[model samples]
Target chain A: MSAPSSPVPAPLGSRVPLAGLAVALGALAFAVLPLLVPTYQVSILTEILIFAVLAMAVDVLAGFTGRTPLCHGAIFGVATYVVVYWSQQGGAPVTGVLLAVAAATLVAAIFGLLAIRTSGVYFLLLTLALGMIVWGVCLRWTSVTGGENGLRGTVRPELLAGHLPFYYAVFAVVGIITCVMWRFVRSPFGLTLRGIRDSESRMRALGYNVSLHLFLAFTISGFFAGLAGALYAMFNDFVSPSTVALSQSVEGLLMAITGGIGTLFGAFIGAAAIIGLENFVSQYTERWQSVLGLMFILIMIFAPQGVIGRVRDLLTRRR
Target chain B: MDRRTFLKTSVAAAAAGAVAMPHVARAQGGPIRIGLMAPLTGVVAAGGREMVDGFNMYWEEHGNEVAGRKVEVIVEDDAANPDTALQKARRLVEQANVSMLFGNLLANTGLAVANYVKGNGMPYFIPIIAADDLTQRNRIKNVIRVAGYTASQFPRPLADWALKQGYKKVATISQDYTFGHEQCGGFCQTFTEGGGKVLGQFWHPLNTSDFSPYLGQLANLGADVVFAMETGADATRLMQQYANFGLKGQIPLIGAMNMTDQSVIRTMGDEVDGVVVAAHFAEGSPAPVTQSFVAAYGKKFGKLPSLYGFSMYSGAMWVDEALKSIKGNAEDRDAFLASVMKTDLTGSPLGQTVKMDDYGNPIYDVHIRKVVKNKDGKYWNEPIANYPNVSQFWKYDPVTYMKQPPYSRDFQGIKKS
Candidate 1:
């Protein structure tokens, strides 16, 4: 494989500062949203924050590394169940959180290893198979996961028990993580990942270990996905097998694509759209699912770059 | 301004105006809101539809008013998932500010909702789900199980009747879940204690398409009777395969009420003949209330009301009775709960009087019925036996029964062929 004679330049100049300002303002709004909005909106926004992280994880794999792994939801769910079950069985909060994150990373590593060998559709299929295995375990292992009923009444500490504090906690964690991810993508390592996405053989020829980088990328994505899951378990005060199912993985991927494949902020926009549709739109009509599908279709046809990406592009073009 | 700018500003103003208008309208006059969460989609859509219809039937009959106040029900489809059920419950309680909550079809969803309501200190009337833990170890004061026969309660009377009939050997086939485990456990425990011989028992997955494999084992065991606990379409599919395997009439099939639901029996046609099951409600009862409900439900839904539909209808009646007793006052939750506890739904959908047990469960009639062809060639469950004022723990001490573990898939007492 040959690289383009004239490689596409990195995003730089005036656009970078403007994007930074936008992100900062977004963070400020998210931090203040709970205080201003109703408890229901706060709850919905918390979920959006958590799902945004998961969607961004998907964006890293599918957008940067050019691989779509369907097991990310399973990775998320495994972490949640581990933390929830541990907490339910009298484990300390910090220890439970650590174990959950570690478990997610380990599952991600295993799933990544299996999927890294395969490219394109095979990667998606392999990850889906892995995700199904996790879902089955959650369903059948009633002793541990509470089977189909799901493990509930998870004991969260006093600090994070209330909705207001919990939303802030999610906001702070997601905000820091998003900043880290922003820097990671703009760094040399991130550039190398984009290079791999552009042309794998060319990158391999330039002394980059392609599979190792991709595997690391997958593991990192899983780490963030797991973080989101652990927070989700705490937020919901319950964990279920549905969290590990293929539908959830598909949702993450859909959010990434809908937000704009390669854009980081697009993940958040996409999550907001999906979660808002489920919560707010469903309140108005019984056929909200159909309406959601129609919205997605319209977004795909008209705003092909995604809500954030298209808005950003239009702003830059106008300038 | 340009056309586009003018159009955008007008639309934005209209949206803002619309959002601000609702609170004013609500403040002037609002109905007492009751929220319902059910699996209105997914695999249980049929059951969900039936339950909602039952709830609506009562309101429609009474002109959508309880006492002097208007009653409004807000329904949310939970998709039969526990997580979604809880989420919808939160939306109902916190967001919609519903005064009361009711209706959940699945046991797990009921438990999840129970936890939420108990935590929030809300009055919840559970009509359909009969999981024992809801009334036993997991029992919370605020949750009122309207038709409170647990899965265990369904099978005890059947086991007693089986012993009376001198059926010594008992084989069980049940769904592999919380509901099925309790059902088969109750039957096996009671039957074994009553001098019945032990036989093979099979716990199949909830969505087993082919029961031939399990039926083969049942054939080999050759028990005197099979106490099966498959429900909904699974029961229909299992009976169809049981007939296909020529074991329908050969084996005396006794099951929970789910097996011979009016809908399931209709689907299976005449193949489900003579299949005895135990339940709280039956179609062919001599009670005038039963006959009236059967007619009213049929006319409204264009189909016969199943156990779920009947229970939901009864739940509405009980709610109405309780509300009327309190003069439609739901604001004081403690008083509302007291009224609910005092509710005796006589002349309601189930065709018998009922009251809450000491544990917030129900003390109601349990019917052991057989699937028989009617004069019109339609199949209905004809009662062969009835147990009145049955509690969730039957006659056993609640403390003693609570000591034993809830029945699960891998109980050690079962004997395999």
Candidate 2:
């Protein structure tokens, strides 16, 4: 079909020091945060970790793959309910959590495949629609989902021991997920996805299946999103449709942008800043949600690359 | 990272864990632990804090002692959101180790804790937030309520108030939720009973900031009276919008106290005057107890206290006082929850004695209050009439009401169909 498409880049699997360093730092913070902050803040941090995982998944689809899959929140909620239902049915909580991610991956696979037929804004709308469908299902299907009353999210059984042990468990899992994602983003598949994002028609002419690549990338993202949801469901001991609403989906995007979408550590930093700010702001102002929204808008305007990503861009650009 | 250093750190961590573990255990205490989960840090945080103050004052006057131990009131925020309410419930049960959980200031919060406490087997007695279903059909066992259910004293009392005022035609406007539905349902049940007709019906999203359309809809109905249910900022905004439509002066209005509380009246200004509201207690309730509460509450907080504070105070006191009756080990789950479940008798500060049936709703009096100008220049609630034994038609059959789907249930006068 005309000019040859750019060759698929080779995987850069040998070493990625930044990702490893981030994990180490995260593990250290995980150990320290509980000691330093109150139980409430620790609870808040645990939530941040959950959201960070979900945001990273969104970043993978939006940044690495360049096709925005916004239905990540709903997919995450779907996983959460699965975990919740399993737990209620006497399934091991951990097994239920894992199943949540698996189910999410399948949903993402199907959604992604259906969505790949569209491009750009159409792709975004498809994801949004899919997310709303999940919200509607959760809202209308009250017998199972609890409707607006919401299922009582019970106290999660601590895996290792208590709060500190729980932190380490989340950190280890998050670190591994991040490492895998980091590797994937720099691999040949990552490069091809980027290429497709940059020029999908050209890739199609080059005989590469753009839809397959996009679907796989989205499926992987959904897997992580589902994992985060399962973790959250177990952690909070509750699941509701509000968790999967369009607002949460938007907040995930905000997290990615606030942290620097392309960077691996951005999601963690974003989650931390957002959650920590929310906690502090709530203590001071009754209008904290509005204040957080303002901060989000400011970040959009001023720190659009996210704190870490912006710093990275600036330092790299200067050099 | 050496063995000696690692051992020291491990010991330190273990010691810290040891210290925290007792707090978790101490929560399951000898004292009657009354957990107060409300929206203490959101938009209604002001009212929530006020409620907490009222509760703390009641505890303080009673020597802050219940069940012979220092009463520890664990205050947590439900964020006026159901999800947060659920989380706070887990925190209260697992961490706070509360003997009895009480006082929900938000409708969804009460519903959330009601459902959750069912599993915890804690007698979660809610009195402040009147979400009818919580007491009616959604009445979870081990959860008793001292507050009036939305269904019991709705549409009827106010609808009658309208009929008494000689306004035969009425219109309804409310937030679209379980609480609003029940309030309207109750009003309709009573209104229609006396042959009063509701001419207009309008519903708006809970998150809606605009009431122009709904206000205009009610205005266009040409009804002699407007009976509505709106709360917090929504109430303030809706009333202001209602005033703009010139319905405040043109049409007589009667709504649930939630439609316009102390905050709403203060914010809604001239529009608040002549607005009739049916409630358990009002700012200027003729009862000497209410006057003292208002004085004590104002002295403590420097503002008129909302019904939230009143209900929360009663809820906390009900638990604190009920624990006194059992005199068993406060931490004994069976003894304490059972003691609370025996709260079929409620003799509290707010005028009427609350009698909770098996399903935990107070089968007690509901009142008809109206906004009238007092010497204070500010419009204060004056309890012009009282329905001493008024309760939901289904009050005696709480289990029956509780068995119905929350959606299928209606306020006493409101239509289930």
Candidate 3:
């Protein structure tokens, strides 16, 4: 989708070095952030990074595959509940992670099968309905989900218990996952998915299994979303119905849109913007929601392609 | 002076001033900062606003000072979301450096805050959340519910009243969350114990716009009375729909806490008249303390103080009393929490002495109130019966009560005969 905007690509010789430098600089900044900020702000930064992963997962479907899977929130939430429930049952953190990932992937596979058959608004509605089913289960299944009060008492592992260590651990995990997703989106399969997105009939004529490619893309997206959810559950050590709610799904999509949907790094920028605005702006004004809404409106109006897309456009135009 | 010298001197002076700021602040003995988290936006904004008003009214009346130290409240909007609540809580404790934490309006937010506060060991006094396990199975040592009651606390007394009124068979309808389950569980437990049967029970989602489907099932039940557990706008919608369905007069409606609370009842019409509900506070109580509070609140806020407002108002008073006991040394966390737990508030606005239970919950009067129109053409909860010195455990021993599972949809359901 962003290809047409870039009429001329930068030479690979210069692009590689520049991209590497940017990655190194970004990693170094995140590594030092906890030491620089207040103790509370470090937690906020950790949350931003975790949510950035979810936003990237949204981008995997919405940006590259040309299908918006609203059920990604439920996939994320399913992992969270799985991890919390597992930990509460005395499972180790590593085992809990596997369980959470597998559960989230399974749910995503089922949702993909059901929703992949449809496209456009039908796909959106199907995904929404599927997500609501998960939410309803989380709410009504009081025996497991604890109803509205939610499941609590998941202690952080001793190794990552402290704020600094936990932040660093999250930083490392999120860093590794972002790199893997970066590779996935650049792979041949990713190209095929994008091809299908641009023209499903052409991709089909070219011998690509369109539905299979879309399904695989969705499942991979759910994998990253589940990992993010597991990290979040560890970060907060609490999970509630709110985690699986429709608002959560909407927020993830907003993050993706605000950050520039297809740009992988834009997810982090979007997460930071929304989280920062919610935390800091609220301290200064009681009408923070209005302020956030206004900011969103301005962004949508001025940079419809999103913050990163606009930045990229400006950079390319200058070049 | 040259421009360089002038600029250098100004910069040096500014740096020195910044360095000296902390010492100056310490010398002044910083104000006792209390962090309040509430749903200042979203669905429960009205209840959240009233809670803040009531809390501030108490402090405002006392000049915002407690035991020679100034009191400063930092209010944060949680947006009724648990994650946001936890984030705001961290901001309050670590960033704002509040001496204590107060205010949460929903069960989810309350539990989230309690969990976070447990790790930090911050003294948190919940004013409005009614989650049962906060005081029951999962009581946190550092968390105290000053003006809060468990979801089941108010309804337990109403159950006995229902049975006494010859309502042998009853139907129940409540919001399908922790609070609702616990509320219905409490009433059913006591009602069934008193030889009354709960014929049917209906659980609806929060913010349910239509109660017609549930009302349809209710009409077929042919039960002696219908007990409803709803709050805020849900209560208003349920009552209005009940009247629309012509089920109000046909079946006696018994509400759980805040069903016809002053905040919601004012929006309702005559259909709510004579509906019986039980709550910890009655806005229309003729007691001197309550009357004075009503008059002062009306003069200031131009409305009756709902249960939300009254709870926070009394919570502020409780905190003030605790601070006075410690001579306002809120910085001494252990001493302050100890003082809070040892509180025995006599002549509180509830028209009785409010005492603290062993599990960090309050033991106070539960009033069985009836909705009525006053001479001023306002609907108020009139105290029809008062159950004095009620605990969250009701009639059972705390140890025995703790042995049973925390109330859920099926755990305390009526037995099928």
Candidate 4:
């Protein structure tokens, strides 16, 4: 049988200049965004970047491995709690980051081990159950997690205390992570994951350790999610049970889907759309939730493959 | 017109309108803009609406002007999340350009906003958040709780009453949170100090749909009285389930603030009657000030104003008093805060002359109330007893209290007298 075609078409040589120009222009806009907007809007932009990292994590498993893990919110939440807990205990920021990411990676490894054996809906259910367990722990473990009130008193490192500086710090971290994720999804290991997504049995017959590969992909996704969570904990200087709630997981998934699953950069677009709509739309109308719901429905109907996916489809048709 | 020309014309119009809006607002004598943040669209939306209504009612009575300045309240929904509350606080201060900040429902949101406002030096008045640290260890000068009590403040009176009634053993079932812990801690501290034994304590997560599990365990505890701490929907469900489990009248039921609050009691049936609670305000108060406030609120909203509404109403009065003293010049932040701190409200709906303590918390009477159906056949909190001039530290020395850690699940303040 012939090899399976890639979901995204290979970039045309003639389109290279346009893509490079677009990338450079987008970067320039983001770099100067804080200066253009009000301080409050800068905070909103920082939140979008952090959440975009979370969306990218969700896309990693859902778009590449064909496994939609519902527990990444819990993974992100664990890191947030770790950072807050560490800071509350007077730990340094660098060490807090190390501990937070390590804790998140460990939680992800355990969840992956339990879930990698299952596929399709079973995998989703298991991850959901694990996520619920984490939520329950966050709620009941009153001392460490601060129960429902959550742990407060997180001091931003003295260097990035100001709003503009903090926004840039988040921008830099998210920028680096995005580059790393971009490379990860295109690597040979990422190709095998995609191959498994297309035909798991075929990949297994080809002597690939499917569970191990899936486990590694899940852990890497958790690492990025943890980094985002760390940034979020610092940005908000607070963490609560809402961070680990089921709605958070669903929102991350929605962002990935709305941007274009499997397209890493689409996560950023999706994050911007969701964050912008939630904040700015509410300013204009009290029925903003209804407006948001309506937008989601329109997107699903008009662009089922998401905004980026539809754009790519249009470009392919032109060819 | 063609599409390009039409677009250009509309864009120019929109830009002109945007630029002209603030000038128009300023032309209206620069109304005293207060940013009111509440959980307007979340689990506590009902309570949040009541807060806004109560606050607005005061301004409405004065024709939307306070102290000769047109009061424009820009309400932003925090959705009961701390992060969202902080963001809204920033938007209110930096973008909306509100001179003052008011209204927060949850303790976490209150603390988050208080911290942010403290840094920004905005005058924030909390009407209904009961977080202890807001006025205790971490008190911020710019942040004042105008018409609110600490979570533990009201419970102290209830504990004293329970002991006077000769109840020797007590059990507590509270929502597992800081608010819950503080409420239970205060009660237990007073009860144990008076030789009452706390047989057991049970905590359930917030928004717990079912109370059967906790009720079943409580039945076995066989305490002389059971003190419950819950709020909003959880309080309504717990009261209903307590009766359903056949444990309602078997043991005396005492509640912390908000369990039998007007907001929750309105939703509850006869199962909640006779339950004792401690709160700063009782809607069924016989005082002339409360009666008039209740009559006006009922005539307009067609319901008894809950504690949420009463607090905001009184909080508005406090702000009005302060603004009137300073000639409505909220632009002078230091003078505004000084005027606010010196406020002595005599006709508050809380049925007391409210005054601020040194710690930026209110010092007022906490009423021991019982749930009862009034002549209108509607349930309301009826004042049974009053603890006059109650403070956040209760009877404990302020220095000693500050030295001790804030109340938590592990530290229930079981004083070994």
Candidate number achieving the greatest lDDT relative to the actual structure: 3
The candidate, 3 or 4, that scores higher on lDDT is 3
- The TM-scores of all predictions, comma-separated, are 0.94, 0.76, 0.94, 0.93
Give each model's whole-structure lDDT. 0.81, 0.70, 0.86, 0.85
Q: For candidate 3, report its TM-score.
A: 0.94
Q: Considering only the true interface residues, what is the Cα RMSD of candidate 3 after superposition? A: 7.5
For B1-417, candidate 3 gives per-residue lDDT tens digits of 465864565466345321011111222366998999889988899999999999999999999999888999989999888988998898888777888999989989989999998887999999798888888888898899897888888888999999889999999999887788889999999889889998888988889999999999999999999999998888989999999999979999997967888888877789889999888888888999989999999999999988889999999999999999999998888999999999887656888888999999999788899999988999898899989988999989999889988778777745455
Total clashes, candidate 1?
0
| Candidate 1 second chain TM | 0.92
Q: Candidates' DockQ values?
A: 0.38, 0.16, 0.43, 0.36
Pairs in clash, predicted candidate 4: none
lDDT per residue as tens, model 2, B114-153: 7666665776767676666565554566766755455445
Q: Which stretches of candidate 3 lie over 4 Å from their true place?
A: A1-14, B1-28, B413-417
Query: Candidate order by lDDT, highest to lowest?
Result: 3, 4, 1, 2
User: Which candidate achieves the best DockQ against the true structure?
Assistant: 3
Task: Tell me the alpha-carbon RMSD of every candidate.
Answer: 3.8, 7.2, 4.7, 3.8
Compared with the true structure, the alpha-carbon lDDT of candidate 2 equals 0.70
Better of 1 and 3 by lDDT: 3
Tell me the lDDT of model 1 at B70. Answer: 93
True contacts kept of 3: 0.66
